[model samples]
Target chain A: MKKEKGKELVAGLFSLLPIILAISIFLLLLTKAFPLLSLKSLPTILFSSAWQPQKGQFGLWPFILGTIWVTITAFILAAPLSILTAIYISDYASGRLKKWLVPVIDLLAGLPSVIYGMWGILLIVPLVGKYLAPLFGTYSSGYCILTAGIVLAVMILPTIVNVSVEVLSAVPADLKEAALALGATRLEVVRFIVLKKSRPGVAAACVLGLSRAFGETLAVMMVVGNVPLTPTSLFSPAYPLPALLANNYGEMLSIPGYEAALNLAAVVLLFMVIIFSLAARLYLNKLEQRID
Target chain B: MGSRQKSTDRRLRRRHRAEAGFKLILLASIILVAIILSIILVTILWKSLPALKLSMILQTPGTGYYLGKKGGILNAIVGSLEVSLGATLIALVIALPTVIYLNTYLKRKSFLAEVIRLSLDVLWGIPSIVYGVFGFLLMLMLHLRASLLAGMITIALVELPILSRALDETIRLVPAELKEASYALGGNRWQTSTRVVLRQALPGLITSILIALGRGLGDGASVLFTAGYTDRITTSLFQPVATLPLAIFFQLNSPFPEVQERAFASAAILTLLILIISLLTRYFGRKLSRHKVR
Candidate 1:
């Protein structure tokens, strides 16, 4: 029995060996490429305004600004729609409506980002340039921050709706019923009882949606115009970090510090995603604790 | 009293109208999302119609935009199949044992299980582009060029978290009584997991694999840097090959109509394949849920 127990422990440790090795190798490479941990390059890399790699200029402000703008724009457009749809499905919709709506939402989630990019290219660019851009301003380029933001909003809608529906559905039935019994209207119950109860979950959903938008590459790449400069307006051309990395990395294979710069951008993107997910995870954990 | 009663009635009616307005807005939002999705699909199909030909699928990468119609995408199709399948196989191999160990041997270790879950969550949250860069750097270090093996490994890393989480959830749903029965009959831990728990979770496991497969097939950016696009099919795992998405990515930006049309047709085919896989997995997921209920 003792020998068998020893073998099991060894096997268990062996299972973890691959992940540990991968993580270590990643960290080692990152540290070697950017030895600026001792020189305080992170703040300059993140907060500086310029990002020209030709003359050793490496400011991430434009990339950061573009990423934030696109994600916030997407969130503003998608959140209310997704939340409303979730409310409809959970409260007002019948079984038939739910059946159709749920599958459609899932199918949306399953569609590849490339398809979204293709749609943006063949459909959105032309329509926006010819019609919507004129209405916005003569300053509008058909493929700008706003166009990419709108497409990203559509891409992230299903994620928000799915999470929001799960959260709203899990709201305690008794709380909602009690509100209804106290002469509260259905809207009041939804606003006060259900929404308030599921606040953490809704927040988690929003953060998750934001993370997805932030990390999105293909869809945004196709529509964002790929100009590596700060934008003056929603209609102005802009380049996001992911798009820059995707477009330039392959060509920069032999260029000194180019691969490093791409890796740094990736590290930044990873950090942003991790922060959002970590916040969401913590919020969910707190919610679970409260329920417990 | 009559006036007061009338005022209350009026207020209630106004509130009802507001509620109805809210519902209308909610319904409109759902309909709008659906319309957008349909428009995207319709637009893609409509635009790609001019390029829909058997030759496009059977031709190789041609020299000129118009004269390049000689070779079909048979090679790219085969390449995608092989790489994606290879990645799926590797992911399943890695995830299955980890999930089995967690669910069976380490069931009592709740802290460890939570840590694993948290790590997996973080892994999933990490963007595919980052995985691409990571894989690229690793390939450089290992001297593994942009080959199918490198691409498969990168995809395996991306798909690992999803497969493991799905497997873990499915394994957890297996009734404790079944494991207890197996143990009572003098079966060992491995035997119990393989014979009893896994047998019960087979449908769910299959669903997980299908989801992973779909995800692998859909991914393009992760493989872009790792699997440098090739025009011809090669049997060796270390050779470079093109995938459908990669082909679309490269071709869509070209000014030629033929190239653009081919991109559209390829996009449609990829979308159809993914949709079919997604539906099948969902069906299996529902089946597994029903079995659990009983």
Candidate 2:
């Protein structure tokens, strides 16, 4: 009887952990942000690009736009390549090659973000400064949206490829065989059967990748030039929401309402990511159903 | 009929060409990813060569080393281990139980479980920077200063979702029959989970913790405000700590070439640590599964 009571107690305690955590996070976010939310309209806070705390102005549009620009640019650059890589791995590669290559992709996923940032500064900055920027008739100190986008592209590529590979591989073998039996070529089978069937999963992969790129801080912070301006060109310095929060949070307490504004920004980011993740999960569930 | 035959031949040729072109593009993209990885590794190694001395590993970072001087990242290295280990332990304690409960106690298809999992996923997706902001606010509210303890707590929050999710999946995958067998033998939920389920999921649990550890070690944003950097090494949880990621971030931003070299060296150290953890995860993962009856 004592042992049974102990079991019930343990189970109840453990089950409360998740509930407590969820409540705590929600409460903390709201409490920190309450002052800001009370003072400013959400639209004013989100739409205004001027973030001068001393002047009591906290428009977050520049950072929001910056985040969108960088994420979209990264998505455009990475999606095609990742999808292609996934296609190669799932539909074309021999068994031995697939075994060798998949681990490398996993390694890419495991690499630290700071290292990616370091590489961005050492190689990507200079390369863009010297070659890529000039072609577009812009000058950069190597810290710009383009460089950040490219680095983000590299960072998110593995995620997109990994998920896409799984999705493509799940395209039933019979589908491909049936396509080939109907006189379709190997590429045709992959394009029509594998690629077509995995669209929802691929969409989920893209949304997940976007969420990652949006939330990424250290690496993007390193290369984004940390400027709070609306970017006029790809090579112009821009600051995203994560970068702003990181760059300013340390000194925020010294200024009145600064901390509150920063907290509101965090709430904004939290909500944005929550939405994207839910969408991704929704699509993934759809993909699961389709697979079944 | 002759004209139709010629058109069909042309279409066939075009389709074959398209296939070849598509294959080539796919191959190039794959190679591009491999090339980028090699480039990053080579560049860090090459740039860090000057500062990658044994003393650099042993000595604490010193002031004015940017003028071609000698100093090591020992403080940051030790600090990273201290904070990450603390965070991992806290996260593990919370996560292991939550996941166990999620898998064993909760009804698998219950709305509560679904909501919990979804909440965790959303939490996992929230960026490290947001966590830093949240931690900063918490520290302010509680009248606490940025310290090792604060850093550990913040990172624990960051890592909790990840570890719990991974652990949840691992525990969920513990063949249902094993749990059923335990129940048949008069074992309660706690006993079955603590024994049969945990033993089967040991490898995965280990891997999940390692993943969290690796991420905590690499992350700089969450600790940027919560863990004030310090040059002096101290074991006290309330004191500030320097971390490898922050070290690299601060050092690389210095204009001096020597300081930048130190940054690269710090990155190399961080990279090496992550690689070792990856290898260990693989090695232990294999070893742990070797005796499995499955």
Best by lDDT: 2
Candidate 1 on A12-72: residue-level lDDT in tens? 7645744564465458547645843344477887788887777666777889888888888
- The TM-scores of all predictions, comma-separated, are 0.93, 0.95
List of clashing residue pairs for candidate 2: A48-A59
Of candidate 2 chain A, the 10-residue stretch with the lowest lDDT total is A283-292
Q: What tens digits encode model 2's per-residue C-alpha lDDT throughout B61-106?
A: 6776656577788999999999999999998988887787778888
Clashing pairs in 1: B57-B73, B58-B72, B59-B71, B59-B72, B60-B71, B60-B72
Q: How far is candidate 2 from the true structure (C-alpha RMSD, Å)?
A: 2.1
* DockQ class, candidate 2: medium
What DockQ results do all the predictions give, each relative to the true complex? 0.54, 0.67
Candidate 2 stretches greater than 4 Å from native: A289-292, B1-11, B66-68, B287-294
Candidate achieving the largest TM-score:
2
Query: Model 1, range B39-110, lDDT digits (tens) per residue?
Result: 988887887787777876776666554344555676677778888899999988878877877777785448
